[model samples]
Target: MKEHKTTPTQEKVLEGMDKVYENLIEFKKKANSDLVVMENGKIIRIKPSTL
Candidate 1:
């Protein structure tokens, strides 16, 4: 298998995405809300506390 290198811009984008995801989870947990997602063509609601 070949290895792929990520550029600096790619790294920054990934880091930003991670931060946004973390914030979303924190907000949901604090508000006692479920995180809505789609899996296997079905919509699912998961509690952040479960994370």
Candidate 2:
């Protein structure tokens, strides 16, 4: 089987996604932040508030 190595940029992008998912899983209603999500390495706008 052939394996494809991940680039640093791609790894960073995946890491950010993991962080967001983990935060959501451990999330509490009282804890939230003004987080901005990036689209293709560019910040589009601030994300909506979490529950």
Q: Largest lDDT belongs to which candidate? A: 1
After the best TM-score superposition of candidate 1, give how far the Cα of residue 18 lies from its true spot, in angstroms.
Answer: 0.5
How does model 2 score by TM-score? 0.48
lDDT of each: 0.95, 0.68
What's the CA error at residue 30 for candidate 1, in Å?
A: 0.8
Q: TM-score of model 1 relative to the true fold?
A: 0.86
Q: What TM-score would each prediction reach against the true structure?
A: 0.86, 0.48
Report the lDDT tens digits of candidate 1 across residue range 1-51.
Answer: 999999999999999999999999999999999999999999999987896
What residue runs in model 1 are displaced by over 4 Å at the alpha carbon? none
Candidate 2 C-alpha lDDT tens digits along 1-51: 999999999999999999997776455333544455689989864433542
